[model samples]
Target: MTRSLPLLAALLALVATTPLHAEGDPESGQRVFNQCRACHVIENDGRNGVGPNLHGVVGRRAASIGTFRYSANMRELGEQGLVWTEDNLRAYLANPKAVVPRGSMAFPGLRNPAQVEDVIAFLKSRAG
Candidate 1:
């Protein structure tokens, strides 16, 4: 029993330190995204509110929304062929400026890792 204790502790430590990726629930994410609706809309009709709609953002090319003008940095990313992938979305939600420096996405970023994951999941479901 004494020898097994140390091995079990080591395994627990390993699990604790592992990085978590977003495997968000679409419904949960939609609920959580309610906080975002005031500033942004997710429908695809090009409604032109304060922020751009997010309906098909996941796989859609960055800065490709014809009506909305994007920041220079975002345009560059699109030019560079940087499509929004799951991992990239996770990182961007964690810190948007870090992912697209000088871009205009002024969201403070979701503080909860799980929420970020959830949002990604929701977006993925709507993506083309």
Candidate 2:
């Protein structure tokens, strides 16, 4: 019993320290991504649209897609070593202008947090 208790405690500690998965639904995120289709593509071989192709974008350095022309601000951000982690994506999606004041992406923003989360989940799903 004493040995089991320590094992159980260690297991609990490991679980507690592990990052919790984001609660967004990837299926729902696909639906949400419909709104982004005019500009972005996530397929591995997808061509750049108004926005750059987003394959493997989840951890990619921002504005690094070679064929797409990025705004000076976007390029600057990338040069500064900004990787597109989930939290960074969330903030940028919530307010493009605020995140990169002169970025060329014209969309206003995703005002709904759930929608933002969903879109991010969709993007992450395609990141492989």
Candidate 3:
């Protein structure tokens, strides 16, 4: 039992250091983000396409991009303080309309949970 303590400690340390959104591969996420290319871009200082620019979007407030117009509901959510946390992103990605009924975004949703995680991971990578 004593011999295993060091291993356990090492594992715990790794868990503590790993980011919360590190479950998915950033590279895989980049590819997955291709699905969003039609409406959004994620590069640093990228411009908004059909959808709002997603650079540094993971922790940003909804409808807060002053350059892009958003639906009233989205603006209201921002007024209500809707920060785009990872979990919230997951929910919205799974069902945009369900999360924000009457929003103008038309992409239905990504049904694959893994793909959603990948996209979130990709977005997080863009934050830096």
Root-mean-square deviation of each candidate, in angstroms? 3.5, 5.4, 4.7
Per-residue alpha-carbon lDDT of model 2 for 4-96, expressed as tens digits? 998999999999998664568889989988888899888998999999998888999998988999999999999999899988888898999
The candidate scoring highest on lDDT is 3
lDDT-best of 2 and 3: 3
Candidate 3 C-alpha lDDT tens digits along 1-128 = 99999999999999999876547677888998888899998777778888999999999999999999899999999999999999999999989998899899999999988888988888998898
Segments of candidate 2 deviating more than 4 angstroms: 1-22
lDDT of 2 at 28: 93
TM-score of 2: 0.81
The parts of candidate 1 lying over 4 Å away from their true place are 1-22
Instruction: Report how far residue 96 has shifted in candidate 3, in Å.
Output: 0.6
Candidate ranking under lDDT, highest first, comes to 3, 2, 1
Residue 49 local lDDT, model 1: 61
In terms of lDDT, model 3 sits at 0.90
Quote the lDDT for 14 in model 3: 96
Residue 30 of model 2 has an lDDT of: 90
How far off is residue 28 in model 3, in Å?
Answer: 1.4
Task: Give the TM-score of each candidate.
Answer: 0.78, 0.81, 0.81
For residues 46-91, write the lDDT of model 1, one tens digit per residue: 4756666888878777778778878889999989988877778778
